[model samples]
Target chain A: MKLLRIYRALLTAQLQATAQYRAQAFLYVLFSVIRPIVFLAAWVAVANARGGSVGSFDVADFAGYFIALTLVSHLCMSWFAWEFEQDVAQGNLSPRLLRPLHPIHYAAAANISYKIVTSIGLLPILLLVAVSFHARFQTTLEHLLLFIPSMILAAVLSFLFDWVQASTAFWITRSSQVSFVLGRVSFIFGGQIAPLALLPGVLGTIAYALPFGYMLAVPADILRGGVDPARGLLLVGAQALWVLLFYAALQRVWRAGVREYSAVGA
Target chain B: MNAPVFVRDLAKSYRVHEREEGLGAAMRALVKRRYRDVRAVDGITFEIGEGEVVGFLGPNGAGKTTTLKMLAGLLYPTSGEATVLGHTPWLRESRFLTQITLLMGNRSQLVWDIPAADSFRVLQQIYEIGESDYRVRLDELSDLLDLGPLLHKPVRQLSLGERMKVEFAASLVHAPRVIFLDEPTIGLDVTAQTRIRRFVADYNRRTGATILLTSHYMDDVVALCRRVLVIHHGKLLYDGGLADLATRMAPYKLVVVTLADGASPRFDEFGEVVASEEGRTTVRVPRESAAERTAAIIRAFEQQVVDLSVEDPPIEEVIDRVFSGERPLSQVRS
Candidate 1:
């Protein structure tokens, strides 16, 4: 109950901070679409050039996959690692550390509030992209039901994944550079640039082996009608397992990292 | 001093990776890097009775902040035992944190671009202060710090002093029992500094909260703390009364004499002339002979010695002497 109150207050403050920097928030949501659109345009052009189809995907199918990837990517985005890097670098963590709450609450609230504020702009822009591209988001009630759990698990898993990276700030200064590479790897393996089915053999195997695909592509794949119900259940289980694994990793890493905290600038 | 803010052999040393400049050295450093242990706060210990507003005096990088960080549970001490309000600080149990506050003058908890009142609300929630109690404390602190006008203003809109005033309000909303203040008055104007010092002293008086404060500003120390712990280069050089500090570091006093006549009898026979200007001369005389020197100067100048008084050298000079090792730790009797 107390944690809930703390989360509420922090979320309010974060929302206000986001509101204050309207341009920055707009740019943040704006940039989320840029990558998916680039991929959509490229794949759709290829499909069109090949007489309107490439293997299992038509031009409309390419549009649907990347568009769904963009929306799901928005849900899975967790930049707490970058924020943690700044907090440690600026000695901002010192004040937060003295508080009774774990510093994670601050980042968690900020993450949610950023999405809430940016989603207002992003939802419309994504709708416009979908309309412009004639995106075919083919799905059924079962897929939608399965997507609900899959995306939630994916979001929680991504946060834990980023949190593990953020925990490195406890020992390594300017850890954001390393954190950025991990984020890029997620885009590569999480079906952001290409559909999971389209990923060449070894890359596909590697993506599924790692937690990144479950963190992103699994839910989008479910939403885009690419998976059977049995496979979707299995994928959701994999996401939950990944969430639990990353969560455990974060707990140990965060504890050790905090132990190594230099309390810089204080 | 049972259950007081206790400490025993507290120390914090950091293993800092070292590397040299130049591409060759950087390349070599990639394969093999050197390391050095910096004892930011070496083994030093002191106890403070509850309600004792003790000043931590030291020059920059004198382990003051490191010790405070350790005590506040922001940094784990390399080796030591410390308890504030009967709980180990470094463990940072929620109950322990609830009872203490660490305020850094250079750092802020207030969210920028938002009214300080909003940030205060967050603090209240974070501290789990009861709604009624939070309201009462907010009113009391706001009234005490004259934060009525500033609380509604965005933190970025407020002046540094105003922001500090709000910072104090935000930090104190929970009414922490042990306050670790690191340079809380830094960058504030004199009026703001005075107000904050008075607020701190008043807060301690009202609540009997133990306060350990570190500041380069001696006025802050002199105004609020009668007992001061002087740490130098990670060592506790002096731990005693502020008055005793002056006596220990500076065994001499200054005798300021106003000469009615521009030309005066040579005062060097009395002591060293520390300063002379505008028909006034100040001499540094041994503490023991200060009274006698004043009497002798009055007699020698006769009616020419218009006015004269004997006083200790400014506290800044005494503190400077302490830090500069004029009175080494071996000599400090504290």
Candidate 2:
């Protein structure tokens, strides 16, 4: 209960603080939409030129996939890898270590709060695009019911993975490289560049095996009604397992990092 | 009860990599890095009782801040045991952390973009300060530190002094029982330094918080700390009353003699003439012979002497002598 209250206060403070940089926040959200829209436009053009069907996707299907992809990508995101690297390098982590609360609470609160605020700017733009494209979204009661938990699990999984990456700052100076590589790898394998269905032969198999798929592609697939019941349940199970694995990894990394911090005198 | 802050042979060492400033050396370091053990805090032990404010004095790289960090639970001691409020510091239990705060002048914990009061609110939740107590405590600290107008302004918008005042208030929002201040007044003007020193003294008096402070400014220690721990090269050289240390290390008194107007009497015969300005001569006399020297000067120039007074030299000179190795640790021990 105490931790909960602290997170709430942290979140409230973050939102108010972030609200001050209105132009920066709006521009960031505005730019985030550009990539997904560009992908949507290209795929739509392909479908139209090829008589409204590219593989298993029609023009409406392309619109729904990219639009859902945009929302899911924004919802499941973490920046603390590079943020923690700076904090470690600049010795800003000292004051935080002295506080009663674990520093993760601050980072987590800031992440959740920033996403909440940015989404306000992002969702409206997404809705406008959805309306303009006349996107036909497959909405089933089962998918709707499963989508909420899957998205939430995806977020938790993403946060944990990012923290694991960030914790490397304690051991290595160039820890940001880890997050950079993670971002590129996830874009390729996590269903960001193209849906797992569109990936060539063995690549699709590789995506299903990695945690990145659970982070992005799984939620998008479930929401778009692309996966069958058995596969969807399997994907959800994979996400839970990844979350647990990362949680364990996070604990181990944090312990080792703190030990290193003590030896080096942060 | 145990001392509010206690340590026994507490020590900290860092293994730092040494690299030459060249591309070739950097490449060689990548394959096999050479490490050297730098002993930051080398077996220094002392206890600070409740409400006691002790100045931690040292020059650059003298391990003052390193010791403070260990006591604050921010850094683990490589060897020996340390406890703040009876709990092992490095364990960092929430209960333990709630009772301590480490404030660094160069680093601030306050959220930079928000008003300081909002940051205070966040601390309140972290420390689980009750709403009623939080209100009362915030009001009290704000009043004490003169943070009324500064509390609402964004931290980035406030002046250095204003931000420091807010820093003080924010650290005390939880009413920590033990406070570790690392150069809390660094980079502030003289007036701001004085205000902060006074605020520290007042806060200690009111709440009886055991404060361990490190500052480059001697005025801060002289004004607020009656007791001090002086360290040199990572070793505790002296730990006692400030005046006692000064008297032991600098065994001399400065005698200021004022002659009659236009009376240009030679003072070198009496003692070491430290300064001669406007018919007044300042003499440095051995502590044992201060009174005798004064009487001899009075007798020799009874008619010429207008006024005379003897006092111990300033604390800064004594500390400098200690750091410069003029006053060896053996002298203090003796």
Candidate 3:
């Protein structure tokens, strides 16, 4: 209960601060939509060139997949690797450590709040793309019901995984190269740039078994009308499993990293 | 009865990597690393009762800040046992964390881009304070610190003193029982320092909050703390009342004599001459022998002496002498 209230307050503050800079806020949200839209257009052109289908996905299907991918990507993204580096360099992290609450909670809240605001801006663009491309998605009550839960679980897994990665700041002075490599790997395997089913044979098999696909493609698949009862249940289970695994990793890294932090000032 | 903050043989040491200064050395360090042990807080022990304001005093690199970090639960001690309000600080349980606040002078925990009051709201949630309680505490703090106008200003827009005032209010909005302040008044102007000092004193008096403060400014120590613990080179030097420290380290009074004419006078028989001008002489006289020395000086210049006065040595001088470890009380008396 306390954590919830703290998150709400932090979210409110972040939104208000973002609102204060109207032009910058608008540009940020617009840029967020533009990136996925460009990706969607490029993939749609590819599907058209292939006579409107690629691995069982037509142009409409590509539209729905990319729209959902954008939303899921926004939910799962983590900037703390960069944020923590700056904080460590400027000695800002020291004050956070002195506070009562774990600093990760604040970071998580800020990330979620920014996503919520950005999603609001994304709604119109997503609707426009869906209507123009005639995207065919299963809008049944059952699919909607499962979609909500899947999105939530996907967010949890993403946050936990990003937190474990950010905790590396305590051990290394610079983790940007490591984070960059991890992000690139996730991009290829997580199905952010392409659907997992369309990947070459071996890569497709690897993506199905890894955590990255569960973070991006699973939720997108659910939104694109690909989740039957069995598959929906299986996707939810995978998300929960990843959440637990990543949470354990977060704990392990936090415990050992703090022990080595030295709390030294720059 | 107030609870005791107990620390048993606290020690904190770090293994810092060492590298020579050169491109070749840097390249070599990339392949082979060497480290040296730095004992930041070495085997020091002290205790404070609830509501007691204790000052941690030391020169730069004396481990004052490091010890405070341990007490505040920010850093794990290399080896030792410490408990704040009956709970090991490093465990940092939520219940314990909710009841404590730590403030650093150079750091502001409040959100930089927003008004300080907004930061208070976030802290309120973190502490789970009821709306009524939050408002009451905010009002009280605003009235005490005169934070009404400053509360709405972005923290970055405020001056150092103004920002510190807001920072102080933000830390206390939860009404923490134990406050750890590290140089809270550092880098502030004299008037601002006095204001902050008074606020701290009043806060302690009203709420009976236990305060452990570390500062390099002796005036801060003298103004807010009755008891001070001095450390140097990571070792505890003295832990006692301010007056006791002064008396223990310095046993002499400074005497200044004024003469009527612009002529140098011989007064070596009275005491050691610290300074002499055309018409005045300043001397350091043993505390016990102040009266005798004054009388002898008066007799020597019965017609020439215009005015004379005596006062205790400044605390800064006494501190310097204590840290040097050479100015013994007996030596000063003799």
lDDT of 1 by residue, A36-115 (tens): 89888898888889999877889888887877888888988888888888888778889888888888788788888988
Query: TM-score of predicted model 3?
Result: 0.93
lDDT of 3 by residue, B66-164 (tens): 888787777889898888888788777877787888888988788778888788889888788899999889999998899888988888899999999
- Stretch of 10 with least lDDT, candidate 3 chain B: B325-334
Q: lDDT of candidate 3 vs native?
A: 0.82
Question: Model 3, A73-156: lDDT tens per residue?
Answer: 777777788777667645677767766788888887778777777777777877887788787786566777777888888888
Q: Best candidate per DockQ, number?
A: 1
Models 1 onward score TM values of 0.96, 0.96, 0.93
Q: lDDT, candidate 2, residue B294? A: 93
- Please identify model 1 stretches exceeding 4 Å from their true place: B20-24
lDDT of 1 by residue, B1-334 (tens): 2656888899999998898889999999989989999999888989999789999988999999999988898888899888888888888999998889999999988888888888887888888889899889999998889988898888999999999999888888889989999999999999999999999989999889999999988899999999999888898888899988888878899999888757655789999998888778999999888888888888888878777888889999888877787866676656
Deviating ranges (above 4 Å) for candidate 2: A45-52, A262-266
Report per-candidate DockQ.
0.81, 0.66, 0.59
After TM-score superposition, what is the CA distance of residue B298 in candidate 3 from its true location, in Å?
2.5
TM-score of 1: 0.96
Interface RMSD of each: 1.0, 2.0, 1.9
